[model samples]
Target: MRHILHNVYSYLTRCVFIFIGDITLNENRMLIGYARVSTDEQTLDVQLDYLLKAGCSLVFREKVSGAERDRPELNKLLKKVRRGDVVIVHRLDRLARSTKHLLEITEYLQHKKAGFRSLSEPWADTTSPAGRMILTVFAGIAEFERAQIRERTAAGREHARARGVHMGRPAKLMPSEAVLACRMVTDDGMPVAEVAARFGIHKATLYRILTRRQAMKSTDKSLNKIEKISQTYKCQLYE
Candidate 1:
């Protein structure tokens, strides 16, 4: 029921903006446009016409997937937009692939004191009061989702550590293979590089494994000393 109401409200807001667009589209703001097609083979003529007909003074078109981040044309359009300018897109998906990306682009436009509108998605018009508030709400939701994901990832890493499961890429050499390589380097006096090469691992890996082992040994000694002190204190208390 709540979702249905939201959709109805959005539709009403969209109609209101469409009505507003007819009246004050070209009052003082320039309508700059951006269009995109997923592949180079796809034609952008239809989208271009829509943008131009919608009163866009300038348009930027690109032949790249919406998921791609290295869109030179989009970057140029963003850099060119100024205060009181409005960016127009044929559709919302043409501008962004996900909600997070959409919010980020809209936030950047807001920072530039510009606005955004979509020919097919009137509810996305940033020039309206409700539209600006909607963008702010979307941005806040995206941020909260990101924070939740980060917390979950941290918790998962901690759970994995508690289970003795390594969290990174598997080691290049097995424990038996590493032990043999270490023996060759230490006892037989073979070069570390040669031992690493024999085990199909890098020299740095050999040094890292040895250094980590030494650190663990040091930690064990410190823990043992602390345990002994704890035991002595308990005995004294009992006495």
Candidate 2:
């Protein structure tokens, strides 16, 4: 009976400690700031002031272009972020190069159970329902833009094909090289594999070239024979 009571008390104490720890962790959750400038000449004073006033405990600063995908300080901040922490940026552009990029970053933060905020754009805050709605709208717009670009590219490719433009990668073997490769295998009595290796092409590719050329020669001979027969019949009638 005493052991059962002791076990119950220990379990209750552990639950209390765990609940208290969660509260402490929540209290310690931090607001982190990120500041960036395109050039060395630009100053981060204003951004720093805003972040400090916004209660950010730490601020990551970088003098790199936001257009660059690999920002060292930004990557470090992202790595250091923890669940329940919020990452604040001076502006949306400081954090992302485009709407698609912004969505990607937010998606990553969402997966980490972190939050995001842009000081200049209230609608970009992920901590609020309204802000999340606005971001969803932005995501939809970015997706539609990507779809339109893909459609235009596909249409352009189709139009090019209709105009007899060869699509995809150019042929690896040139006309003269193909002829030489075929001859090296047939007339020179060389192994097909050896000829293909000398021509820097697969043996299968060499075989395809040979088959196509032979078919063309057969078609040409058949056409020539038909022309000769027609001429002979015309000469007999005239005689």
Candidate 3:
């Protein structure tokens, strides 16, 4: 019982010391800033200045294409941010090119208990309810735009097919090459792997060429038989 009591006393003393240390430590709220430029011609200085003025303790800048997902500076900024921190950007577009990507990033920050703010888009501050609503609307629009593009592309393909116009890339291998490849494999007793390697083609491509050649040969044979029968009938009628 005395040993147990001693352990409890020590635990309480450690807790008291930890509490005192925490009280002595100065807590400063982190204000992290992220800036991006879509092209080399653009500059991040303006965004950096605005972010600094907006109360950012640290600023991260990236001169890269917006379409690129992996950015070194952006990763570093994300790693540095902690719970109860604020990540500020010059604008919503500066943070992400697409609405979906923007929402994803912001959602991660929300999960981390970090706040998001945009200097240009005042309504993009996640601290307010209105900002969340605006973001939802933007996400819906972005998804709608993507769906419309897909629909138009599909409709265009259907129209082309109805007009008997072939869609997609033209055949890469010529008829002669296909025929030669088939002959080499079937008649010459050459291995498909060797033939493909010799021609600097993939095994799948070689197989497709061989199949096309066989189909063409069968079609040509049928036409030749019909021609011969017609010739014989014409000769019989002349005699």
Candidate 4:
């Protein structure tokens, strides 16, 4: 009876230890932070400070344009985030410039079962129910605004086109310059490389112009030969 009691006590102690270990594992908070600066004039330090003060375990930052998609630090931060982790940002706009991009990032986090928190905006935390609703509304408004802007731009372009205004990059070489380069290569027997260097144009451009000229000449010659053959055929038939 004494040995049996001792064995039972040992088993109970082991069970308690396992239970404590599980609780400790569940209590670990995984928090990550991300910050961005649009230009050299902007500083990421202020954003990073707020994230640290808010209890972020790790932080990532980048000095890149908000319009750019391929941000190295942002990618690293996303990869490091695990399920049940929290991603903190100073503001939503700092994370992404466009509403579509913002929604995409947020949705990805949600899919990963991670939460999002904005230090400045209390209504921007995904960990709460109200915050999720607020973010959905905000995302809808942003997408609407972007669509309106795009429509206005398209209308403006159409109006300008109606007024006979040209759009897009201006021609790099004038028609006269292109014609002159073609003549130099075809009639003057100037080497394409020399012509390109002399005219301050790229060798590729020179080659393109020369090739176009050659194609035109070939087409003209083909038409002339066809006309001659037709005339001879007509004469022979009449004779």
Candidate 3: tens digits of C-alpha lDDT, residues 1-239? 35434544553453233222221112566888998887865577888899889988888988888666567786666556676788899988877756656755664455455678898889897656667556545544544454555467668989999999887643354333443444445544556665554344555666656555445676654334423333443333323
lDDT value, candidate 3, whole model: 0.61
Top of the candidates by TM-score: 1
lDDT of 1 by residue, 1-239 (tens): 35434544554454344323322335688899998998745699999999999999999988887556567787678667776889999999998867856765665565456788889987787888777666656654554555455567768989999999888843575443444444444434556665554344556676666555455675644234323333443333323
- Candidate 2 local distance difference test against the native: 0.64
State residue 133's C-alpha deviation in candidate 3, in Å: 3.2
What TM-score should be assigned to candidate 4?
A: 0.47
Poorest 10 consecutive residues of model 1 by lDDT?
Answer: 15-24
In candidate 4, what are the lDDT values of residues 184-214, reduced to their tens digit? 4543455656555435555666655655555
Off by over 4 Å in 2: 1-25, 40-42, 161-239
**Candidate 1 clashes between residue pairs 3 or more apart in a chain or in different chains:** none
Comparing 1 and 2 by TM-score, which wins?
A: 1
lDDT of 3 at 199: 43
